[model samples]
Target: MATVIFTKNLERHLSCPSQQVSGTTVREALDNAFSDNDQLKSYVLDDQGRLRKHMLIAVDGSTISDRIHLSDSVNEQSEIYILQALSGG
Candidate 1:
């Protein structure tokens, strides 16, 4: 199982605890993690089931490239980090 960790900033909005979920890809892992928490899922993904513009995911220290499908691979020891992207002008 992969360990999913939500950022502290995101937790400020809602209670998103770290979870150990089973999956071989980022999407599957997140689906398992969000199975009981639809609100957190909504916060991370858009209506089209795509990653929201402000949401970011890092799998074992590297950002994911397939935002729409979240096809990035993961393993049992993987650490998946989910966070809101910061932007400033």
Candidate 2:
């Protein structure tokens, strides 16, 4: 099972807890984690089911490429981090 972790900033606003879930893809792993708390899902994803503008997801410390479908692959030992990206200059 892959471990999904939400940043403290995100955790402060939403109750997204680190979870150990099983899945072959990032989307699957996220969905599995959401099974425990669906509210967390809505916070990270928009109505289009795409990652929200301020949100970033990474796998194994590398940035995830598929923001639209979240198709990034996940392994048993993978660490998935969901972060809130800072914007504005």
Candidate that scores best on TM-score: 1
Give the C-alpha miss distance for residue 26 in model 2, angstroms. Answer: 0.4
TM-score, every prediction: 0.98, 0.95
lDDT (Cα, tens digit) per residue for candidate 1, span 7-40 = 9999999889999999999999999999999999
Q: List the residue pairs that clash in candidate 2.
A: none
lDDT of 2 by residue, 1-89 (tens): 99999999988888987989999999999889988676888999998889999999989989999999999999999999999989988
Judge candidate 2 at residue 35 and give its lDDT: 86
Work out how many backbone clashes candidate 2 has.
0
